[model samples]
Target: MIETVIVVLHLLVAIGLVGLVLMQQGKGAETGASFGSGASGTVFGSQGSGTFLSRVTAILATTFFLTSLGLAYYASHKASAVQEAGLPDPALQVEQVAPAPVLSEDVPVIEEDVTPVPAGEDVPPAAE
Candidate 1:
């Protein structure tokens, strides 16, 4: 549930950033080159300050950065509750890799010989 909420928040922030950027006019827009007004007022009213759109863009951009960082943090952290339910500890999993089979160091392995005999020759003595 937390993962889903984070995913949704991340997506919303991404979309908001895209929208905010698109809504702002470009540098070459005609709002600056018209009716005796220089490129100053059209941009920041000659005070060199950002406009409402600029402020909104900044806020959304910050949200985007924060949400991105949050998603990354959440991704790296495993949920302890989920991991503790009948699940093997990740650390011990590798250690428990079935200790290599221990062979008897003192015993020598011997192979038995198997032979087939001719069918008719001696009807190997019958039990009396």
Candidate 2:
């Protein structure tokens, strides 16, 4: 349930962020003739600053970042819901794997003697 709530919040915040970004007026909205073309500074307006849309965009951006972090945390730390309720802890199960087969040091092994013979000697013929 908590995970679902977090996911919903993440989606809502993402949509809100997109809307706020799109609503903002892009740069270079002015630079055309300024009615008389004297020196109309501060392109937004005579007030020389941003408006509510910019502020809302900033707020939505922060919220989106927080929600992203929250969702990441929720995904990483979530427990496996499929585990049976009455089962023993998984930490103990490793001891129950069958032990690997053991080989005794006394077992005999056939080994070829690869020592180099004298350079000119031919190899002995195989016994029939």
Identify the runs in model 1 with alpha carbons over 4 angstroms from their true place. Answer: 30-50, 79-128
Tell me, by lDDT, which candidate is best.
Answer: 1
* Model 1 per-residue lDDT at 75: 59
lDDT of residue 62 for candidate 2:
87
Q: In candidate 2, what residue range of length 10 has the lowest lDDT sum?
A: 30-39
Model 2 Cα lDDT, one tens digit per residue, 10-61: 7998898887777665555434433535334656554324476778778878
Q: Give the clash count for model 2.
A: 0
Model 1, span 79-123: residue lDDT tens: 564476767756666554667877797888787664566887765
TM-score of each candidate structure, all chains considered together: 0.47, 0.47
